[model samples]
Each structure stands twice: as C-alpha cells, then as structure tokens.
Target: MKPTRCPWRGWLMLCLVWASGSASAALPIEHWTQPNGARVYLVRSDSLPMLDVQIDVDGGSRRDPPAQAGLAAATALLLTQGVQASPAGPALDENAVVEAWADLGAQFGASAGSDRLSIQLRTLTQPDVLDAAVALASRQLAAPAWADPVWARERARLTAAWREAQTRPDTWAGRRFADAVYRSHPYGQEARPETWAAIDTAALRDFYRRHARPCDARITLVGALDRASATRVVDRLLAGWANHGCTALPAVPEVAPLTRPERVQLPFAAAQAQVLVGQPGIARDDPDFLAILVGNHILGGGGFTSRLMQELREKRGLTYGVFSQFSPGRHAGAFSVSVQTRPDQADQAVELIHSELRRFVEQGPTEQELAEAQAALVNGFALRLDSNRKLLDNVAALAWHGLPLDYLDRWTAQVGAIDRDRIVRAWQRVLHPDRLVTVVVGATP
Candidate 1:
C-alpha cells in the first residue's frame, strides 16, 4: 500500500477552494463508538467528492520490546506488502495489492510514529469506488501476511540506510542526545543493525496481534460523507476486524527528568559542529500545553522572530540558523535547541543558548513579544484546516490524545488568551536551565 514501488494507475487529485474564516468556525466534528468498540470521529466536508480516512493504533515504537526496538515500524511496513487469504477474499501479494488499489483510484499507507501506528486511505466518494477501497484497506488492517521474504528485503534496505545515516555527524550527536536525556526510558531506544537483524516475522506478527485491535483504534473520517454514510463505511472497513477481549498492556515507564547537567563531546572529522541542548519537557495532556507552546514560540519556535534566531543568527552570526522545539507526546518528550556552527564556535554557541534559556525561564517573554506571537499564530490558524487531509490529521490527533471535541474550535481563542504571566509561569515550572544536557559533535580541540 505504500505507493512507492508500485504506483497507482488511476489516481485523481482533488482540489477545493477553502473559504477564509476562523478554522474552528467551519469544522463541526461528530463522535461515536462502533459496536466492535472502535472510536470514530467524523467531519463532513461536502465541498469535495473525495474521502480521507486515518486509523491510529497504540502500536508505535514506544510499544516495541527493548530488544527489538524497531518492531512496530517494521510491522507497519509489512502490512501493505501482502495480506493473508481469508473467507472474505483470496490472498494478495505486494504487487497484486498495489494493483488492486491502483485500479480503484485510491491511495493507502501505514506508518509508525513515536506514539501511534497510523493507517490512512484516500479515495473518491463514488459508491462503488468507496466500498472497494474500504474493503482493500480492511484486508490490510486485518490480515497482514508478515512474509519472511519481504521482511528480509526490508531489513536489508533499512540496515543499509541506517549505515549511511551513521556516517553523518548530526546522527551521532542526535543519538547521544537522546540517550543522555531519556536514560532508561523506551523513548530513547533507537534501532540498530543488530536490533533490525533480531526482529523476524514471528515478532512482527506478535506485536500486531497484541496492539492493533479494534478496542484500541481511533478512526477519523473526513470528506464528502454524512453521518449515515460515514457510519456504514466504518462498519464495512472494520467488518473483518474482531475484538479479542482486549486487555490492558503492561505500562512503559515515563521518560525520566535529568537530575543534573550532562555533556557529551564526540570528535568527528566534519566541517561544522552540531550542538544540541535541553532536557525532558511537557507531555501531551499537560494542562499548561498552550502556555508552554506560546512560551516556546518566543524562545525559538517562531522562526525569524524567535529570540534564539534573532540572537544566535542575526546579531552574533554564530550560525546560519538555530531552533528550539518541544516534542510533547503521551509521556515527556525532549525540549531541545539545535545549532551548527564553526568547530571553534561550538562552545560559544552552547553558552549563548544556555544564557538565553536561563534568562527567558527566569523572566518570561515581554508583553509585546506575547502579543506579536499571539497575533501571528491566531491569524494563520485557518491554514491548518485548509484541506480535508489536514482536517483528518487534526481529528485523529484529538481522538488519540482524548482532547476535547471543541479543541479545534477554541484553538485560536485559547492561544490568544494566553498572557505573558502565564507563559512565564509555565517556563519556570517546566524547564530547568541548570539541569540541561549538551551534546557537541565535531568540535575542535
């Protein structure tokens, strides 16, 4: 289903003219649970004749066994390669599966992220086409073949890609940074050649069976379907999926916070030094997520207007560009600042980052800064929902994270209401300037 090797023959791209207004004003979401226990979220967009669907399962890399770090990713990849035969249909190999979708003028794919494994489909809303595409997707979701030959080929390709990535200095720095920040947490686990080699067909199948269940599905549908049609589509797509009395999974430990400053220095023969700094940050469900988001935009996430870019790039000429980010997830993800500069200036760059972060944490953003950030974010919010595909992704996120149904409707207003004092309070509570981790690779002696 990954349209990579075998392309769709009759794929038609849909175009629409989205009206200019508050994004929340236009999106009205409907939610319900199927009898099989899958949670469904739908947004009816009648302006287009296409349908976009996304299914999110809790089988992301975070669920992988420590010994087989990339198991979830590999499993997601193989789902599209082939499917086993069942009473509903005959078996289909990778090429045959691709041809089936191509003939239907639809696209389907599966990929794993840090928190979830997502299966997505895009197809025309014609009755005949929609039914066929949903049936094919159901085959992929319910009956992945997990063929040994395909795993062997994928592993080799991934291993070679891994080897090539290792030759880059940024990769070395990133690995060290993750290990230092996450320590014993599963969030830090990166698949190695040996780990990829260790994963066989059996482990992939086991992971899928355990995690990819109807009970755990958060399905989102967006496009030209009303509630009735959307409900029927959901039922048909999940017809082959059966609940097996789902039980709770053993909980993975949360990402631990750093107790003290940690520094990693690795010398590599490269032109520029890669410097990374920071520690564990907020989780997705944190009440202060909006405040922290605004705080980060002022710190480094607002691009040219961000403090980090203004200081490190524009004023001091330390690097061509620099950035800070908060990668919040089910658990605490990293809050990192990254930069590349001359080997000789690595230390200076790190110190500037430390000072800027410390000052911002101690004294929150100015009122003027907060106003500008709010205006920029609020005005541009509508672009986030300009297409059905984009809306599907947002709806899927809301379902997966248990965010309020009105979250999108209130996004801009809530962001605008965040004051300077709240931003300061959030920064002080969330970030520890003294306990940051620093990783500098390819630095001069």
Candidate 2:
C-alpha cells in the first residue's frame, strides 16, 4: 500500500513519442462473470514464464467513512497480515502465507487507492504454483483474519505515520491543495490524527464488509493461461464466494466548482512556495478524455515541452519544473497545475499561470504543438502497455470503470483524432481561469 497521504502520480508528458508506422497487436480481453457476480477480464500471454492476476474492488479511500479516513487502507494492509482460510484447508496466517508463496517462488502484493483496492500475484507458470496462488488469493479476499492484535499494530503504525506527515512541507502543501480544490468532496478527505483515533478494529471490519464486495469487483488476469484453464482456476478458487451484497456508498456527489478565485496560504517556511492551480477535470468515461489528454500534454501534462514548463521554467527560471495532470476517479477528477518556486516569486508564479491559462483557452494548441503531442502520446501509449502487469492494470481500470472493451484499441485512434479545435473547445468547456483555486505554501508575505 502507499505510504503517503497523496498517492496519485503526475501523468502525461511533453515530447510523448510516436513512431508513425509502428503497429501494436491488440490483445483480446476475454470477459465473463462468476456465479458470485464478480466480473472477470483475462488476457493470456505466453511471453513470460509468469502470470499476473489482479483483483480490484471499488473500495478506495473514497469509501472511508468521514469519521474514519484511513479505514480502507488499513483493511487492505491487514489482509496479508492475518490468517486466511480456504474452504477445506487449515487457516494460513501472515508468516505462513508469506512462506507458502515463497516456497512456490511467487510474489504477492496488495494496495488500496483512491479508486480501488487491488491484490496482485505473480507466479511462475507451473500449474501447481498457479493453482495454489489463486486459491490463496481467494482466501485473502473472502476471509482476512480480522484479529484484534493485528488491527492494533496497524492502527498505531498508521497514526504515527500520518502524525509525522504533518511536519513535512510536501504533505502540508498536498493537504491544503486537496482541501482548497475538492472542498467538501470525498476526494479531498485525508486521514487526520483524530480520523485515525476514531477508527478501531470494528470500524475497519464494518468498512471492509460493506465496501469490499466481490459482486462489486472486477478480476483481471494476464500471462501464461488459456481461457479454459484460467476459467477453471478462477471458478474453483472463488467457488466459496457468495453474491450477498451490502449497502453501497452514497453516489459520489457532483464535484462542486470553484465559485471564485481563492488563494489558500499555508505557513510553511520552506525555501520555495508550492503553487497548485485549476479545478475538476473530465472523468474516465468522459468523451473529452482523449482530447484532454492531447491538449493537457501541450499545456503541462507534457514534461519539459509543455507550455507551463516553457513559461514557468524555461522562460522565467521561476521553478525547476512545473507539471499538470487530469487525475480521473469514479466521479469527476481534478485538473491541477503545480510548481515549487522561490517563496518571493509566489505571486508572480500565480499571475504567470493565469496568463498562460488565459492564452491556452483563448488560442489553444498550435498545429505543430498538437502534432508533436499526438506523436508523443501515440508512441508512449504503446510503451505503457508493453508489460503484462501494465496490461493488467490498464484492462482492470477499464473493466472496473465500465469503459468499453475496445477502449484500448481505440486509444491511439482517439488521440489521433484530437485536433486544435477540439482541444481548444475542451479547455474552454472544462476550465475557468478566473475561478481556479490556488494554494501557495511557504509563500513570502
């Protein structure tokens, strides 16, 4: 699981490369449903001696009860740390579980996120090892130990970690940025000291039971297994699963827009001011997603060649680097621009950001800029799916988010179809330069 308050990494890049004639063979994503109502997606690849299987549910931090912010993450971590029981075998505990997989030369890892909780296993393609790994996964999902001692230790560890996070400048900036941009939305919620204190073992269990439903989850498998064999493995492993469902979390409310330009100042005396700008962005299913991707690259999602980088770093040397991202979740996601600069330059940074955003909305990307961005997006897009694990993540996201199966195949086509007019029009619809939220931590008075 992630160790920090903010787990999302900046996505998109400048100079994203596209090799004009390069062709990528589309891997078929096999889809099916288990009797227990779990949706499954599979892609068999014999290229590796190993197989990667991932189980994802919609039990992300967004499901954390307002009173107990870290409950979702704690439950995810405690799964591997406790006893897991299969239908007929003796229960396996933390160490035993680790040794069992090690004995088979396989790896088991899991983490919870803002959108989902995932347990991933990597094992050599031996039939016995694969079978055991799948069985172990099912057990972990169906029956985590839910023991008091394990909960106590994890709670203490998380409390200490979050308490310490408060002392760091980066953490300070992130917390303020999230609060300012997301306002009352769950996406802005972070685990505070009191949030930790309120979450006991019972809270964790209840949160897990209600939100971690297999019926509400998607299973993705990649590497070294055919449809028939994989089907048998999944069916047997998850046979004990039941379709009993629980109450669903409130539908994520519509993300509120910034009614006016507001700047939040956090008193951190670090050398540079951390400025984050912008507001809610397109969602995964938003038709504008591809266009936003292409346009954002030209704006700031692209690394150095992005307009923000060009303005903030290349032209003024106000910061070493500045980047932007369109972070999509179950609901509308956030679109933000961030940079760290000399504390004294905070005002200038914010002004420059607004100026560039104004120009971007009014003028849009140039033909040369769009062409370069498209090339980079198309080229980098192939590399993003080059590995089995990457393929599993990409496909699992699609399966979980209910995007069309052909979404991957259509990715490049969509990126190619994005033009200056569409890009400009998207920015105009999605962003309001005057209504953006600004967070300046460590700024000079």
Candidate with the greatest lDDT versus the true structure: 1
Candidate 2: pairs in clash: 13-302, 14-302, 14-303, 16-376, 17-376, 18-375
lDDT of 2 by residue, 1-445 (tens): 6344211111101101221122233978889987677788988776554667788877888878788887778878887776555555778777787766655556677788888888787766666666766777667667777777777777788778887887777788788778878888888888877887887777766767776666876888887789888777677655644545545656877678778887788768687777888788777777787888888999998999999999989999999999989998777788889989998898998899889998998899999999999999888887778666677778888888898889899988888888899988888998888888888888755
lDDT of 1 at 33: 93
- Give the poorly placed runs of model 1, Cα more than 4 Å off: 1-11, 16-25
lDDT per residue, candidate 1, 92-115, as tens digits?
A: 999999888877878899999988
Q: Hey, what RMSD does candidate 2 come out at?
A: 6.8
lDDT of 2 at 412: 89
lDDT of 1 at 53: 91
- Candidate 1 colliding pairs: none
Off by over 4 Å in 2: 1-25, 84-87, 245-249
**lDDT score, candidate 2, position 289:** 79
